[model samples]
Each structure stands twice: as C-alpha cells, then as structure tokens.
Target chain A: MNIALKEIVKNKVRFSILGSIILLVSLLTFIISGLANGLSQDNASLIKDLPSGQLYMNKEAEGTYNLSRIDPDIQEKINSQQKEAVAFSIQMGFLNDESGKQRSVAFVTSTESKLFQKVKPGEIVLDRSLEEEGIKVGDTLTHDQFSGKLVVKSFVDQKKFSHAPVAYISMENYKEIYRTEDMQLVFVPTAESSLLFKDLQSFSNRDFLKTIPSYSAEQTSLNMIIWFLVVISGMLFGIFFYMMNVQKIGLFGILKAIGLKTSDLFKMMWTQMLFITLSALALSITFSQLFTSLAPKDIPFILTIETTLQLAAVFLIIGFIGATLSGIQMKRVEPLQAIQQGEV
Target chain B: MLTMDNVRKTYVVGDVKEEILKGISMSLHEGEITALVGPSGSGKSTLLTIAAGLQRASDGHVLFEGENMTTMRPEQVRNIRASKFGFVFQFAHLVPFLTVEEQLILMLDVSASKMKKNETKQEINKVLQLVGIEHRKDAYPSSLSGGEKQRVAIARAIIHKPKVLFADEPTASLDSKKSNEVMSLIRDLTKTLKMTTLIVTHDEDMLRYADHIIKMSDGKIL
Candidate 1:
C-alpha cells in the first residue's frame, strides 16, 4: 500500500499547484543560466577558447588587460625560453566595407603561432558573425588609421571579444593602426604556475578572463539570480510541506496510534518529495531544452546538459533538507491528543 | 488476557500536580467486552490509553498475557501494539485519503501481517462484511455517513486479527440508534473473534453489550 502515491493521486488539485510552482521556478532557473552562459561566450569567446595557460602582463597595468603592454625584449625572451609561448595584442577598432558601412571589431595581432590565424600584412581574417552581416571572403575592408585596403582572407567561428567580432590582422598592420610594436600579453601554453617573469604579473586562463571589464559583473549578477531561485525553490518545498504537515497532524496522530512507525511516515514524505521534484524537473528540462533550440538567433542562450543535471541535483538535495525539516513536527505528535481532539 | 495493577497517571501543569488515575487495578479477560464508563474527565479515556500502550503510566504495571508491558522498551511496546493490539478512537479517525479497502490494507501493513496478497484481500472483505459495510468498501471516509465511517474504523481495527482491541468512545459522534448498532457490532465481533476488548464510553445504553463494566469517577473505579 503506497499511501504516499495514493494521497497524491487522491488530492490532484492540491499537489498540482505545488508541482506547477516548482516547474515554473526550475524553468526560469534553466533559462537564466543558459542566458548567462551565452552572454559569457559572446563577451569573451576569443580568450575563453585558448588552451589552459599562463598570461603575463606588465605589472604596472594593475589588472587591466588594455593597460598592460609587454616589453618587446621580455616577449622575445619568453618566446625563446618557452617554445609554445605566443605574444598577442587586442584593440577595439572599426572596419569600413566598400560601401562605407562601419562595423565594430576587435583587431587582434599575434606572433607567428598555430594558436591564432596567420594573416599577411595586406589580408585579414574575420569572425563568422561579420560574414553574416554582409562581409565576405575576398572583400576589401579598410581601416581609418592604416590608410591601406586589406582583403578579407576568410572567417573563423565563435571568435569574439568584448561583444564585438574579431578581425585577425598582421602585426605590421596592427602597429600601423594602433602605433605600437609591443604586444599586450604573453601566453605560455600548458605552463606551470611557478614560472615567473621580471616586471610582469601572471594570471591563469580563468583569472585572466576576470580582467575583461563587464565580464565578472555580468556573470556575478546572473549567477546570483540563478542561486536565489534555487534557494527559493527549496524554501517553497519547506513551506509547502510544512503547511501540508500541519493540516495532517490529526491524521498522523491517528496513524501513529494505530501502530504506524514514525520511520514509515518519514518514508512516505520522502517518496512524495521525490515524485514531485523528479516529475517537475523532467518537464522543466524538456521545456528548457526546447527553448534552447527555438531561441532567437540574437538572443544569447546556451543551456548545457551538464549544467542542467547539476542544478537538478542541487534542487533535490535542498528539497530533501527542506521537507525533512518540516517532518520534525510529525515525530512530536501524540496520538492521545488526536483521540481527544475528535475527528481528523 | 490483560491486567492492570495499581495503574496511576499524573499530569502536571505550571507547578501543579494533578492525578487523573490513582492506583487503579483492573483486569480484562479473553473473549469478553469490558466497558469503562464515567462522566467527563473521569480518567476512563486516560486509563484506556495507558492499557493500550498509547502512553505510559506514571506508576503501575500493565501485564499482557503474563508479560509486563510497562517494563518493556518503547520499541517493544510499539511492536506489541502493532502486532497484538488494535485501536478505535472516539471519532472514526479514518485516513481521509484512503478508501475503506485501503484503510484495512494499511492496518495489515502496519501490523506486518504475513498473509499473502489474495488472503489479505479476502480478510479485508471478510471484516468489512462482518461490520456490514462491505458495500461501501470503495468509498473514502468523506463519502461515508457517520454510521458507515465508524463501521470502517472498526473494520480497520480488527483486520489484523489482533489479540486485544482498545476502543475510546467508538460511537460518540453517532446518534443513539447508530451508537447501539456500533456497540452491538463490537459485542458480536468480540465474541466471534474471541478477542479481549476494552472500551471507554460514558453512554449508559451501551453498557448492556459489555460482559463486564468498570465505572470510574474522580480517577478511581467504583
């Protein structure tokens, strides 16, 4: 006799209200988490796609990547010492097409390495997003400061920086446009943390991303909202079961009087919690995944299976704690009181 | 058979001590119905609860089949209550969500009965028929009338075939006609099952069904 399941089946309206609330809360959480991830990818996919490594910037830059300019001598020395090391620089600029349409882009130039696209002085590589905006391979695009026309060589996928498309240009063109020969940073691929360079500070790939303005602030706020929703769902379970348990106090007392074990009562409560949570989560996962596929192209939304499972696990654990907290009252009920209090 | 020797129950409220049952001794024989009749707060209900192991006596010995229940551990007592004792409260107190059939099934599960599934179903139907409510076995407590709900409660109490049955104001919520029906049903079941039955009630008309009557007042039996 599965009394837990029987009760749920008997009281459809009461349980459905709780199930719908959980469904809405979990769906909102998944969607928000997806947007946060999408915005993160849009904000810094260029740096995020790099292999795990150490980034060296001039110590005087004070954690600001744009302000950091690595000396040419130090860059060359590290490049010679670590064969995999690459020196790179990025600057926000504009590219004008043949029709004079100005498109914002992050101009990037790096030392000869397989990690970045190699472009000739008179050629450029563009991000795929720019190709979608009417810029194509072999199109001649010019910059205001360089005074030269560079043909777009090809396009790379997902290479974005600071919410703008990346344009891989030659070091010579970059120097001409920005007037600097020194690169902003040195990246040593698969480098150990103990390695140190004089007059420079080191940051891991993850810490380096924090140096990008708006990245940390944006991610922090979105993550806070996701966690708040998770916690509120837990509290919802606590209060819901608390109210339900309060209403059933007399019933519980009668059951207890009739020789039902306290552990049996707890088992019933747990079974109901699992049933409700898993059902709501299954629906929410299905709906959120559907939203991911149907979302507008301009909307940054990327919900991964791994993140969904992790959040689901958290909701289950928190719900268990919440329901168990409310069940403490069941252990305190005296059958004599219910017997004396009259009908259940 | 069950025996209560010098049973005393004391309740304390705000530094004031009140004795509800003052060292009362009684015994219930097998295959008989014993009624504890009294006015309000006469401790008949309290005595019934103590004998049924729902609570502990402040001081006394409760012996069931020659085993001292008051000295046993709480888990052991609860085990006895589940496997050897049955209870019917003042109100029907039927589980609101369960149908009449499921209520009996729940009791069988609580008692850890060894009957197979088909046998258990047969036993439930048998008890429901004995209480004259077999036609309403599929109904929930809310759908049942006052008389029908009490019949289901009685069916649940004895479905496990317990050795002792404890009822506290079993038909207090029903009218005089329905009360007599319930009382007669209790008497017939007690004799038919050969089970020891102890009931607490203040109604004088119900005493005719009891083979033995212990009237209580001011915490002492007269």
Candidate 2:
C-alpha cells in the first residue's frame, strides 16, 4: 500500500497547488535562462561561435579589445609561428542601402582564415539578419567613411558582434573605412599559448569575451535573477512541505504510535516531493522548449537541452533538501502528543 | 503478555526533574482488558504509553514475552511496536487521506505482514466486517461519522493480528451511545482474538468492559 501516492490521489487539489507553484517557478527560471543565453548569443556569437582558443591583444590596452592594437611585426611573427593564427578587427558601423536606408552593422575583417566568412575587396558578406531587412545579393551598400560602394556577395548564419549583425568585408575595405592597418586582436586556435610575446597578452576564449563592456554585467544580473528564482523555488518547496507537515503532525504522531518507522514517514514525504518535482519539471521543460521554438525571431531567447536538464536536476536536489529539512519534525513527533490531541 | 518492572519516567523543565511515572510495576495478561484508571496528572496515560512502547521509560525494564523492550534500541522497539502492538487513540487518528480499506492495508504494511495479497485483502475485509464498518470501507475519514471513524481506527489497529491492543481514551471523542459501541467492539475483539489489551481512561462508564481494572494515584497502583 503506497500511502504517499494514495494521499496525493485522494487530495488532488492540495497536491496540485504545490505542483503548480513548482511548475510556475521552474517555467520562469527556464524562460529567463533562455533569454540570458539568447542575449549572450546576440552579444558575441561572432567570437563565441569560434572554437576554443587563445586571443592575443596588446597588453597595454588593459582588457579593452578595441583599444588593443597588435604590432604588425609581432602579428607577422606569431602568424608564421602558428599557421592557424588569425588576426581580426571589429568596429560597430552603419551601411546605407540603395534606397538610403541606414542599417547598423559590425564591420568585421579577418586575415585569410577558414574560421571567418571570406569576402573579396569589392564584395561584402553579411549576417542573415540583414536579409530580413530586404538586403540581398548584388545590392550595393555605401559607407560614409569609405570612398567605394560594396556589393552584397552573400549572407551567412548567426554571426553577430556587440549585438549587431556582422558585415564581413575584405582587409582592404576594412582598412579604408577605419583608416588603420593594425588589427585589434589575434586568435590562435591552440591550448598552449603560454609562449611569451613582446607586447601582447594572451587570453582564453571566456576571458576575452569579458573584454566586451556590457557582457559580464548583463550576464551577472540575469544569472542572479535565475539563481534567485532557483533559491525561491527551493524555499517554496521547503515551506510548502513544512505547512503540509505541520498539518499532518498529529497524523504522523498517531502513525508513530502505531509503530510506523520514522524513516517510513520521511520516505513518504520524499516520495511526494520527487513526484511533484519531476512532474512539474517535465511540464516546465516542455513548455519552455516550445516557447524557445515559438518565440518571435526578434526575441533573444535560447534554451538548450543541456541547460534545461541541469536546472531540472538542481530543482530536484533543492526540493529534496527542502522537503527533508521540513521532515525533521517527523522524527521529533511524540506519539503521546498525538494520542492526547484528539482525532487527526 | 506484557510486564513493566519498576518503570520510571522523568521529564525536566528548566531545572526541575519531574517524575511522571515513579517506579511503576504492572503486568497485562492475554485475553484481558487491563484498564489504567486515575485522575488527571496521575500518570495512567504515561504508564499506558510506556507499556505500549510509544515512549521510553527513564529507568527499569518493560518485558514483552521475556524480552526487555526498555533496553532495546529504538529501531528494535519500533519493530515490536509495529508488529506486536495495536493502538487506538482518543481521537480516531485515521489518516484523513486514506479510505477505511486503505487504512487497514496501511496497517498491515506497517506490521510488515507476509500475508499474500489476496489473503491480506480477505483479512482487511474480515476485520472491517468485525468492526461493523465493512459498509464504510471505501469512505474517507472526513465522511465517516464519529462512531464510524472510531470503528475504522479499531479495525486498522487489529487488522494485522497484533499480540496486544493499546487504547488510550478511545471513546473520549464520541458521545455516550457511540462510546458504548466502540468500547463494546474493543472488548469483543480482545476476547475473540485472545490478545492482551491495555487501556487508559478517566471515564467511569468505560471501566465495566475491562476484565482487570487498576486504579492509580501518585504514580502507584491502588
């Protein structure tokens, strides 16, 4: 006889209230987490999409990627030493279409490398988002700083920088627009980049992402909210079970008096917790995944299966801790008290 | 059979160590309803709980079938309490969520009974009928009348065929008519099952059902 299950089945309304709260909390966490990930992708997908490697910048620039100017000689030496090394520069700029409609774009140029979209001097490759704005192949775009007009050659998928679609242009056009020959960063696709350079500081992929001004602070606040929700859910689990346990104190005492093991009472509470958490998590994950797919393209929301699974595991563990803490009173119940307290 | 040899229970509040059961000794025989009757604060309920293994005595031994339950580990005592003893409290104390039938099934599970599934079901039905509650087997405690709930509590207590039945003010929550019905049911079941029974009650009318009535005052039997 599974009394735990029977109790849940018998008092559907009571248990559903707890389950709904868990579902709502978990759903909120998932949606917020998705937004956080989406915002991250929007902020730096151009750099993040690249494989893990070391990014070298001028040591004197002090963690600001734009201010970092790699010396051409050192860049040449490292490029020769590491064949996979790629030097790149990104500057937020705008482009005017044939109709003179201006659109924000990140002007990006990299040395000959397979890691980036390659474009000829007269042509431009753009992020697919520009295509949504009606820009297409053969459309000529003009920039205020550059003397020449750039014809759109093609569009690539999901390449963004500093929340702007990347416009992959040739080194010649990039130099003409920016009027500087020095690239801002050099990326080497190797784990061991501990080799000393004269004026460059080496950073891992994650450390380099932090060089972007608003990225860490934005992620920090969003992550704080996500964790706060998780903590609140955990506390809610504890408090809900605490309230239920308080109501059942007399019943637990009577059960104790009747020779029910204290562990059995704990088991019952845990069984109920596991059932509620799993069911609630399953529903929330499904809804969040649906929301991920159904959300408008403009909304920055990305929920991955790995993240959802990890959060689900956390919710279960936190709920277990909460419910178990509340059940401490079960072990403390005196059957004599229940015997005297009048009917449960 | 159950025996309490010089059992004492002391509870401390602040600095004072108050003795609830002071060196009490008693024995309950099989097929007899042994009533512990006394005034409030006279420790009849304390004695009953100690003998029932609901609480541990501060000193001395509680022997059930020659085993000293007082000295046994808590888990060991709990095992005996689950298997060998049945309890009916002042309130019906039926788990409000469980139906009458589930209540007995829960009891059988708590007792760790090895009866086959069909046999357990048969035994639950048999006990429910004995308590005149077979008709209410599917009813939750909330829907049952006071008498009916008490009957279900009794059925749950005895469904596993315990060696001893402990009733503490089992009729306290019911009116005269219902109290009489519950007391009569307990008496008949104790006799039929040949189990030793211990009861604690202040009500004078309930004493007639007990085969051996012990009056206590100041923690000692009179």
Q: Give me the candidate number with maximum lDDT.
A: 1
Candidate with the greatest DockQ versus the true structure: 1
Q: Compute the DockQ of candidate 1.
A: 0.88
- Can you write out model 2's per-residue Cα lDDT over B1-222, one digit (the tens) per residue? 899999999999999989888898888999999998999999998898888888889999999999998888988988998999998888788898888999888898899999999998899889989999899888898899988988998998899899999998888889999999999999999999999999989999999999999999888888
lDDT of 1 by residue, B1-222 (tens): 899999999999999999999999999998999999989999998899999999999999999999999999988988999989998877899999999999999999999999999999899889999999999989999999999999999999899998999998887899999999999999999999999999998888899999999989999998
TM-score of 2: 0.97
Candidate 1: lDDT of A115? 93
Candidate 1 residues lying further than 4 Å off, grouped into runs, are none
Residue-by-residue lDDT tens digits, candidate 2, A1-344 = 78899989988999999999999999999999999999999999998998988998999998898898999999999988889999999999999999999999999999999999888998999999999989999999999999999999999999988899999999999999998999999998865667667888988889888889799999999999999999998899899999999998999998988888899999999999999999999999999999988999999898999999999999999999989998899899998787777766
- Candidate 1 lDDT, A190-302, residue by residue in tens: 99789999999999999999999999999999999999999999999999999999999999998998889999999999999999999999999999999999999889898
Query: What DockQ number belongs to candidate 2?
Result: 0.87
Compute DockQ for each candidate against the true complex: 0.88, 0.87
Please list all clashing residue pairs in model 2, or write none if there are none: none
